[model samples]
Target: MKFVDEASIKVEAGDGGNGCVSFRRERAIPFGGPDGGDGGDGGSVFAVADPNLNTLADFRFTRVFRAQRGDNGSGANCRGASGHDVDIPMPLGSMLFDIATSEKIGELTRSGQRIKIAQGGFHGLGNVRFKSSTNRAPRRASPGSPGEQRELRVELSLMADVGLLGLPNAGKSTLLAAVSAARPKIADYPFTTLYPQPGVVAVGPFKSFVMVDVPGLIEGAAEGAGLGIRFLKHLSRTRLLLHLVDLMPPDQAPLAQQIRTIQDELRAFSSEVAQREQWLVFNKCDLIPADEIEAVVAAVLGDLDWHGRHFVISAVTRAGCEALCAQAMRWIESQAPRSEQDLMDDEISAAAAAAPDAEAGDEDHRPA
Candidate 1:
């Protein structure tokens, strides 16, 4: 399936049913009172996250969604049935936004998580509700309110533990294939991998992490160059970044200069992403003579003033790939948990902390 990261959709909630204003007409009863039943509430619209889905292509064809209207109220105290709610299945990690106000509704980060996009209209009142001592035979009934309608912008951000970054033909896909089971297209020409591909890299039994490989970036990528920065959002949730560089390339630019170009583009795209912890991985080390490898690595590191961890690997030969994977797993494990459990706990704590303030506000508003 063609990966679609963004899409626009229209959602309409069901409208409430109209109330009835009828009086009971029983046999031998001269003063039959009002016994009209109330109308049922309308159905709402919600967006649910589906783990099996990874793209928004399904929403492209079906751009509009409308729920069922509520049933009308009946006489003799017979209530109407409510309308059924509508559930929209969207990919996990999808963010919803209001197109008119550009307000962020919420993001679906967990499987089966749901967020309400539109609310149903309230039910109309019946004549019985308005009946009082003076107005025993009330004839007026309020009409049902209209449902909420909204146009939403859906954007998907991939969830991964590690992200790959580099220029074209830098052996990123090769490294991914060597370390994991993902088989992205490999070619000598640039732009072979047109989209982002995620793979699971297992360091050992019961120890693994997800890694995502996006299309290689180039100079002026932030300014809509080759492939642009469209796919970069896939890395927004990643904890670590692995920057791949070809040890030997056809271009005459220095290795340090090549690295700097990618860095500038990354910073241009997202400053927060540029602040992520990155490790330099020089690929195709087998092409360089063994004795000159150390000197070349040293020169590039010194020229770039890099102080972080670096690795020399041959992706085609699977050399040094194991160590890289192991280190990545360890680093990911060392970081703070980004799981749903922690998020839920934080929310609970926040709500608990706010309970006292709510009580205090109630006390302040109490009758004196």
Candidate 2:
């Protein structure tokens, strides 16, 4: 999948069938009335949410969508066949906006959800309908009305319970692989993960939540210094953010400033993202000497002025990963279920919203 999140398309409804005009003729009848048939109704156009889809990249290939046209009516009081309704399949979290009116017309968050994009044209009338008391013989029939047509813009935002945030090579991929079945690319280089990868982390039997791993952030990322601008929107839908910090950074990196760099970027990008509930997680503890681990942790905390919830884990060894995931599951269980309306509030990505960022993250990272 190319992972395209936005697309635009044109849709048109089917046209109605035309009416028939004819008069009944019989050898035995002295006078016969009109017996024209009515025309069939046109088909409407609709957009449906499909659970199997995850991106709007497919929309790039086909843009125009038209419904089936109705069959024309015939004489002898025969009605024409109605047009078939056209239904388009799209991924969940995708929203449709009207181009001309700039209106938020429809949003598809749940599977099997459908919304009408255009209405089919009305069927035409027949000459029999024009017969009146004053005018005994009618020779006129109405034409079918044209179907509705319009252009629309579609935007997709992936929804998740938890979002992982950190600098590049922050062990995001390793942690996701440890906690779930997702297999993200793991390398020692920065910017190894280019996009967001989601996985289901099971806390217990039948208890789990979706976790999205976004690309790493570097200094000045909010200013488009790195790939952060492209993927920052992925965090907006998350209820909680897990900030992973590398304990044993290469070249003896500054522990305190490492956390602050990510923080600064997030705040600069969006206030909502900066203000979210973020839990500081010290990663790669296995790399630190067992004897000096306590002192190093204490020093890192002092540098960060840490007072909030914190955790120490090693993704490579799977140490403390289970406990961390368990706690996350419990936290999600305690919080209220998020409403679909919340997804519309984020403006982090190309789409504007009131929530956090718009579309992406890979928090399981920062190389050891």
Candidate 3:
């Protein structure tokens, strides 16, 4: 199925059945009384989070949803049956918003979670309800109340252990294919992957984490350039971000400059996401001269002033993958119990100890 993460729809609750104004007629009875029954309440509309659903494609073609209407009341004092409630299934991590008011209705963060969006109409009264002492006989009956309706927007954010981010053709998809079973489309050109593709990477027999390959980002992405920030929201739920940078970009832009571009976009998109644990993975190392690999990694590291963990790997040759996977697994495991600030502090300490004399930025170059 084509992946659809966002959708807009209209939801309406069912209207209540109309009331009846009938009178009872009995044999051998001198006088008969009102015997009309009340109408049944209408069904409500609800949204449920389903773990099995990964996309919002169901709402793509269908934009309107309505519950069943209640049955009308009958004579002889018989109340009609209530309509069955309707449950709209949506993917986990879906957020609902009111389109008219721009207010957040609620969020479905877990499977089986449900929220009511529209309320059912009230049951109407019958003539029997009006037969009081003041009036020996009454013929008036109340009509059913109308149901509620709403226009809603649903947005989905993927949940992943790691999110891959970089410029176009930066080898994110290649790395994902090398590490996991996901076979996302790949090409020699930029923007080969347009959507977010998630795969499970196994570092141990029973240990693994989910990795999401996000589409490439260019400058002005946060302000609606290129594919825009629509796809960026998918990375909001990631535990960590893996920034893949090509060792040598064909554009000939300084590798540091490319890294800076992506970092700036992340910061512009969301500060909270920008602050997530991010690791630099200098990809396509095989393309670099074998003798210059260490020098290039060190130079890029110096330029980035990177404090977090990093890796150098060739996704095509699968070189350095095992080590990268192992280290990532270890880091993921170790950080499960630590706070975000602690992790940052530890990374800073490591960077300071590793390159005590290396100044990341100076008068000659700007911050990467």
The most accurate candidate by lDDT is 1
Ranking of all candidate structures by their TM-score, best first: 1, 3, 2
Q: Residue 231: error of model 2 in Å? A: 3.1
Best candidate according to TM-score: 1
Residue 240, candidate 3: Cα error in Å is 0.7
TM of each candidate vs. truth: 0.89, 0.79, 0.85
Residue lDDT tens for model 1, 263-308 = 9998998999999999999999999899999999999999999999
Q: How would you encode candidate 3's per-residue C-alpha lDDT over 240-356 as one tens digit per residue?
A: 888998988888999888999998999999999999988889889888788998898888889889888889899999998888878778878887888899889999999988673
Task: Give me the runs in candidate 3 sitting further than 4 Å from their true place.
Answer: 334-368
> Where is model 2 poorest over a 10-residue stretch in terms of lDDT?
354-363
Error of 3 at 272 (Å): 0.8
Determine the backbone clash count of candidate 3. 0
| Native-to-model Cα distance after best TM-score fit, residue 65 in candidate 3, in Å | 1.5
In model 3, the clashing pairs are none
- RMSD (Å) of each candidate, 1 decimal: 10.6, 13.9, 11.2
lDDT of 2 by residue, 151-268 (tens): 9988777799999999877898899999999999887665557768999998888999999998889998899886747778778778899999888777577888899999999888
Residue 68 error, candidate 3, Å:
1.0
Which candidate, 1 or 2, would have the higher TM-score against the true structure? 1
TM-score for model 2? 0.79
